[model samples]
Target: MKSQLLVPAVYDFLENMEFEGFDQFYEYAIKRDVPVVSKAVGNIISFFVSLFRPTNILELGCGIGTAAKYMLTKSKANYTGVDNNLERIEVAKRFLKDFNKLKFIHSRVETFLCGTDEKYDFVFVDSIKKDYEKIWYLLKPVLTKRSMVIFDDFFLYGYIFQEEAEIPYKYREGVRLIKRFINNIKNDPTAEIVFLPIENGIMVVHYEG
Candidate 1:
């Protein structure tokens, strides 16, 4: 029940898709043990979003900037990636040196939101599950009618902890919060929601026009 099985299948499918500069970064990320968006799922979402061709993109919790790099190369967007981990930001900066359109900020998502004056056509939420709602609230005011928001790792990895007794309540609580957040978005008139069965599950929200 290792998620490893899903990896190859997804890789094979994405390997055939055409996206310039993606394969190299994907390969590098896989080898460097950098936590980026899963190649298969990331490509699918990137491909779909590329059709819209967002002009400005924001990524929260950019671990090592793999996803931001891929998004910049694939969607050709002006990308800003934020992460609280300075060490990871350094690695991402080194890895993504060639992309002048991409920028990385070493700040917590919550802190960045309070001070940033820029609005984005797309916002990607990759922060921890417990902080999802908070991040969403911070960005909600800035989202334009056509802005798209993607939340990664929304699905619970059920098989991973199947055998463990006295499971942590936080895991269950986290899942519940995610579910509730999705429901709240679905009920809102400003956004339309869809859940994709990608790597861990990505909840995509398109701001209402």
Candidate 2:
């Protein structure tokens, strides 16, 4: 059976929660066929921002700044969004021009993480499954007290729980890496974690050190 966390009815309800002008960008994203966070995912991110009220946020794989817009509007926090795709960053910049607290960087996340000494109160990882572990390693050193690091797409469309033989040949390697990320965090002593059943799957890791 599939995970009930992503029930269509639940997603339909969350997707309709409104933010001014969000739908325009969202519709544009769909028409352009570019990758962007689902509305349910954006709702969850907004919920977290309201609850935690973090002052600084860093987002990985910030495609077109959709998620960044949600975070900025909801949290009213300073945001740094990184994406390797120049075209997406350009679009993100255009749409996010009004928000002085938000900035988009067109650089690989690994490179950005290496060169920045800044620590953030919240970190959102929306990168590919295989790269999560590497990003996590680099992300650890930049977390502050009571910081929350959120990892999106943890369920990988339910593929993470399937047997290796059952998974498609092309996805097996990436699925394995994501599973390794789950396992490592489960055993880690320095972080407190919660897995939320909101869209695909969301994992929030609270740094204890």
Q: Count clashing residue pairs per candidate.
A: 0, 0
Model 2 alpha-carbon drift over 4 Å, by segment:
1-5
What local distance difference test score does each model get?
0.74, 0.84
Q: Candidate 2, residue 21: CA error in Å?
A: 2.0
- The stretch of ten residues in a row with the least summed lDDT in candidate 1 is 158-167
Kindly report which residue stretches of model 1 are placed more than 4 angstroms away from their true locations once superposed.
Answer: 1-34, 158-168
TM-score of 1: 0.82
What is candidate 1's lDDT per residue for 56-142, written digit by digit as tens? 899899987767766776677788889999988887888788877877899989999988988888888888876787788888877
| lDDT tens digits, residue span 54-75, model 2 | 9989999999988888788777
Worst 10 residues of 2 by lDDT: 1-10
